[model samples]
Target: MDIDHPLALLGGLTPRRFMKRHWQKKPLLVRRAIEGFASPLARADLLALASKEGVESRAIVRDGERWRVKHGPFSARALPAASRRDWTLLVQGVDLHHPAAHDVLSRFRFVPDARLDDVMISWASDGGGVGPHFDSYDVFLLQAQGRRRWRIGRQRDLSLRDGVPLKILANFEPEEEYVLEPGDMLYLPPRWAHDGVAEGECQTWSIGFRAPARGELVRELLQRVADEAAEETSPLYRDPAQEAVESPAAIPPRLQAFARDAVAAALKDAPLLDRALGEALTEPKSNVWFESSRVPARLRGVLVDAKTRMMHDSRHVFVNGESWRASGRDASLMRRLADRRRLDARELAAASDAARALIRAWCEAGWLHETGESHG
Candidate 1:
């Protein structure tokens, strides 16, 4: 994408301008962000996906002054009647299960893939809603079908209403309101409280970004780095000359220093940390799984699977929770694959023998497919 080129998706602001002005700082409302936009999946299709095992879904129903939430693999008989009011079914990671949904997700690739998360679809009945709440991550809410009335505010009070099944704001004060029609979109930065109520039956697509907390990020990276370090040769602490200590229960100062050095050694390896970060970022969600396939004896082109997560750094290429060292021309080719998600005949032909072998291995792992094959 041309970061300088204006986009209807960002209300005519270029991606560069939008990132500088509104991203994680304020809200943006774009009318007709997608001209004549329609949902990729119909209501019935969404219900079927929600009923499938391994997919994440939830049903929320409002009953007068009370609200209730339920998890799914919901059966067809488990959902509320079509005419029922004040109910919603939320299916997470729709892109992982449907090709059209994956295409819809690809539209937002202007953001880096590492931070871009999956698309979620919310199907709701008349008067349906999940109530006023704030997300810790940024989101673009696009109205796909029918209409929804949204009340929004930059909320200061983050307290939740006790006894509610959902994390609903207790003091939701709307400063602005709008009725979004099909193709309209609203972008909300993290912690911007908003409530959407369906005017009638409706569906909305939410493109959410990941914003891992500092501690969570550190913990994951450290764990990966330490695990890698453990596989390498390292000295064990040896206190051969110990003084007769009066405090047998207390940890020795020398032992503490050795432990500190062990951790420091792991953290000091810059390349290891970088590889770990790339692998962790590209790791698929826990519920995601891929089927193995036989590799073709000959290949002309390839397409990365929608369910596969691939990323690259200067020193390494990572995909599906695994990392490999990459440099020079091979690194460039791998990076291109990560960026474009496909390699045509001409591009594949440019790969060296080793790189071609790696590509075939990825194909056999079901991370990518031969040109004529269907995307996963």
Candidate 2:
């Protein structure tokens, strides 16, 4: 992707321009962002996915003055009829379940993978909606089927209605409105309030990005860094030759300094912090799992499993919560695999004996798959 070239997806704004002007600062509505965009997952396919366990899904219905939501594995028999109005089913992480969905997700590679969350599919009947609400993360709402009328505002109240299953705004202030047709898209920065109601029936794909809160990141990183530091040969707390005239309940100043030094020591290793961050970023969601694998006798081209998350930093590569120290040619190859998600004949043949063994180990762990006969 050319950083300077205009993208129809951004409504003629270059990616650089979009990031500079609109990202996290305002909303953008692009008509036909994906020209003639038909949804990769059909309604029936979405329904089937919703019925499977390990997939996150939900059904929302409006009943007169009340609204309700139900968690799924929704059976095919459980879904409301197509003719039915005022009901919707949402399936999260569609990218992990279907190949086409993953391809659609790949379109947003302009953004870093660590920040990109999964694509969610929303299917609704006429009058269906989850009510007006704000997301904590940025989102691209791409209209893929039928039509949806959206009313939006930069909400300030940010209060939710009482006793509702959804976190709907109690005071929705619609400052603008648009009816999104097939291929139209709306980008909303975090906390931009919006509501969408199906015109008749619709499917919308939400490309969401993860925004880790400062406190949340602190907690995750501290835990990982502290665990790593524990493996180091640090001396146990020692307060030798102490004067015992003070209160027993009060922690000593020496102890406090020791505790502080422990934290400082954990942070002292910047490379450890990098590895921890990469591992945390690539960690799979709680619902994700992989099948057991075994190494083949001969090696070939390979592909990373769709569900596997891989990322790298200056000194190390991370995948599915595991970190590896990588350098030299092997590091370059691993980074390429992380970026492109596959290795071809020439790339595979270039691997050293140790690198080939590591690749075989990953294949045996189900992180990668052999695609063809071995060339080496």
Candidate 3:
């Protein structure tokens, strides 16, 4: 994806410009971001997905002054009739299970794969909603079916309602309103408050981006770096001259400083620290897994599903939590796969023998699939 290229999705601004100007800075509303957009999964299809054990889903219903939330795999009897109003079914990671949903997500290739999270589908009845809330991460909410009325604002009060299952805002202030039909999209930066109510039966696809907190990132990176440092060198405690103190309650200041300096020295290698950080950031979520299949010897072209998160930085290629050292033409080929997520027959032929072998391994692991195959 050319970040400099103008996009209808970014309101005619180049993705580069959009990222610099609006991403994480403010909200952006684009009409017909996806022209003629339709729900990739039918209502029944979504319900079937919700019935699966591993798929995350929730059913929300408004009953007068009260709201009810329930985990799903809900039977037909559990749901109100289609004509009934004020209920909703939300299915998370629709892109992971539906091919068309994944295809729709590929349009946002302007964002790096590491930051791009999953797409969630929300199907709501008339007057149904999850209520006013704010997300800690960026999101693109695309209306896929019927209509939804949205009230949005830059909220200052981050307080939540007490004793509620959902983290609803205690006080919501709406500065703008929009009734979105199919194909319209609203982009909200982190901490932007928004509420969407179904004007009627509707489905909305939310493409969410992950934003790791600073402390969480530091912890993960430190752990990864420590593991790498441990493998490289085994430093034993050196206390050549030891004296027993009359007061045995406290550690010696010299010993404390020595331990601190040792840790500091271990972390002093900037390049090693960066590599570990990259690896940790690209690690896949625990629940993610790929299907296994043998690669054809006469492989022609390969296609990576948009739901597959793959990334690379400098010395390593990271895919689904696994990291591999890459160099020469192999590194170039892998980088291309990371960028485009697909390779034609000619491109495959251009790869080195070692790179082809690596590709075969990825194919067997189900990271990459042979193009034109009937896996779907």
Candidate 4:
């Protein structure tokens, strides 16, 4: 992607311009954004995935004015019939299950991988919808199979309906409305209230980005730091002074100081923080598992698994919840692999022996696949 050139996906604006103009600021609707777009997963294929364990799915049924939501690992027979009106099936993380969906997600690599989440697909019957709601993260709603009419507004009132499973807006005031067809997409920033309803049988693909809450991030990082702290064989806290306290119930101020010192010590390890963050970012989903494989006799190159998360900073290369200190030619090559998600024969040949051995180990662990000239 040329940063200076306008792209149809951005409604004829360059990525830089789009980011400056609309990202986290407003919404953009692009017609024919994916010209002649086709859905990656068919209806039957989607339903099959919904039935599988570990795949997150939901079914929402509209009962006149009231709505009901159900979690899924559903049998097809348990789902509402195709003839049933006003119901929708939503499947999350379609990108993880479908290769084409993953490819579609890669097009948005202009955004950093750390912030990009997975793609979700919603299949709906005529007159179906999940009602008016707002997401706390950025999203691109792409029409895939049929038409979905959308009403959007910059809502000030964030109140939700009482006793509802879905977080639906109680007072939805529409500022504009549009009917989206296949290849048309709408980008909405976080908390921009919007409602979408299927005009007929339709499928919509949503590429959502992650927005980590500050507190959540801090807690996770601290958890990682604390795990490392536990390994320290520090002597137990000792106050040898013979002064006895008058109040037996009083907590010691010296103990509080010791607690602060321990936290200060954790913060003092600068590289530890960086390593923990990298590990956190590359941590796999709870349901994700890699299949073990045998190593080949000779390695030519490697391709990262679609499910693998790989990234690198100045001192460390991170992949699949592990971090490695890299420098010189090896660091440069690994950084390229992180960026491209593949290492060609020439690039692989340039790596040091140790780096090559580590890569081979990862391949055997199923985080990557060894590629050769004849393999393709």
Candidate 5:
């Protein structure tokens, strides 16, 4: 994707310009961003997905002054009828299951895949909404089906309502209001307070980006680093001079320093840190798993399934929850797959034998597929 070229998806502004001018700085409302945009999955289809155990879904309903929240796989009978009002079904990672949803998400490829998260669909009845709140990550809310009225502002007080399942803003101040019709989209950066209430029965697709909190990221990376440290064949403990501590209950100063140094040394290798980060970032959600299958003996072009999430950063390639170090031509090919999500026959043919073998292994593991072939 050309970052400098203007795209209709980015409101006729080049991604480069948008990133420089507005990204994480303010909000942008683009009309007709996706011309003739249609809901990729129908209401029934979305509900069907919500019923699947592997899919992540949530149901929210406003009952007078109170809001009710529930996890799903909710049966259709559990949901209020299509005619019922003030309820919503939210399905996460729609791009992982629906082709059209994936295609819609691919338009934002100008952003790096590592930061890109999955698309989520929210189906709401008239007057339905989760309530006024803010997200910690950036999001592009595109109206896919009916209409939605949005009220937005830069919030100062991020207080939540007491005793509600959703983190609704306690003091919402609206600076601007818009009723988004089909093809209308709104981009919001982290902590920009916004509320969307369905004008009628509506479907909205939120293309969200991942922004891991600093503390959370450090915790996850440290855990990964510790795991790697445990696998090392080096010395575990070294105490050449064992002197009895004056305070029996107290930890010796040397031991405390040694423990800190050990942790620091384990994380001292930049390459290992990078690899761990890549692995952690690309780790799939708990329910995500590839379907195992056999790859044909004859090699062919490879097509990554839209349902699978693949990503790479500086030092490693990540697919599902698995990670691998990429080097040489194989690294290049893996990077290509990370970028394009597919490789043609010519590209595969040009791959080194080791790379081909790796692809074959991935195919067998169901992480990849041979183009133009049925899985079954």
Candidate 6:
């Protein structure tokens, strides 16, 4: 993508301009972000998907001042009827299940894959809503069908209503309001409170970005590094010169020093930390699974699986929670595959013997498939 080129998706702002001006700083509403946009899944299809095992879904029903939340795999009978007012069904990670949803998600390639999360579909009946709430991460709410009235504000008081299953704001102060139609989109920064109520029946597609908390990121990276570093040979704690202390429960100074040194050694490997971070970023969600296949003899082109998460750093390529060392021409090829999500015959033909073998292995592991093959 050309960063300088304007996009209709970003309301005529170039990728660079959009990132600089509005990305995390403020809100931007784009009317007709996707011109003539039609929902990839019909109302019935989305409801059916919500009932399937391994798919994350939720139902929220609002009655007067009360709200009820339910987790799914909901049965067909479990969901409320289309005519039922004040009810909504949300299906998470729609991109992982449908090709059209994946294509819809691919348009946001201007954002780094590490920060890009999955698309979620929310379907609602008349007056349906999850109520006023703020997300911890950025979200692009694209109106897919019908109309929804949105009330938005930059919320400072993060207090929640008591006895509610949802994290709804106790005091929602709306600064701006709009009724979004099909193809319209609203981008909201993290911690911006927003409430949307369906005018009648409606569906909205939320393109959310990952925003890992400092402590959460540190915990994940440390665990990953420690798990790998434990396999390395290291000196055991020795206290040959230690004398008995009066306080038997007190930790030995020498032992504490040894513990610090051990941790320092684990963290000192910059490359290992980098690899761990890359692998963590590309790790698929818990419910994701792949179907294995052998590489075809007459491989022409390859497409990365929709469920596969592939990324690269200066030293390694990470795919589906796994990492491999990459360098020189092969590194370039892998990077291209990650960026474009597919490589044609001409690009594949340029790979060296080692690179070809790696690609074949990826195909056999179901991370990549022959271009014409049917896959999720």
**Regions of model 4 farther than 4 Å from truth:** 372-376
- lDDT of candidate 3 vs native? 0.85
**Per-residue error at 90 for model 1, in Å?**
0.2
Model 1, span 180-233: residue lDDT tens: 999999999999999999999999999999888889889999999878877888
lDDT of 3 by residue, 34-126 (tens): 888888678899889888877888998887657889997777778777778888899988888888888777888788766888889999989
Cα lDDT listed for each candidate: 0.92, 0.89, 0.85, 0.89, 0.88, 0.93
lDDT (tens digit, per residue) of candidate 4 on 22-45:
999999999999999989678889
Which candidate gets the maximum lDDT versus the true structure? 6
TM-score of each: 0.98, 0.94, 0.94, 0.96, 0.95, 0.98
Residue 256's lDDT in candidate 1 = 95
Steric clash pairs (candidate 6): none
Which parts of model 6 are misplaced by more than 4 Å? Answer: 244-247
Model 4, residue 215: C-alpha shift (Å): 1.0
Better of 2 and 4 by TM-score: 4
| Residue 74 in candidate 3, Cα distance off native in Å | 3.5
Model 4 per-residue lDDT at 129: 93
Measure candidate 2: CA RMSD.
2.7
Model 6 C-alpha lDDT per residue in residues 1-376, reported as the tens digit of each score: 7889999999999999999999889999999999999796888999889989999999999989999999999988998899999999999999999998888889998999999899999999999999999999999999999999999998988999999999999999999999999999999999999999999999999999999999999999999998897888877778899997899999988889999998898788899999999999998999998888977786799999999999998999999989999888889999999999999999999989889988988899889999988767
User: 368, model 1: CA deviation in Å?
Assistant: 0.5
Backbone Cα, N, C clashes tallied per candidate: 0, 0, 0, 0, 0, 0
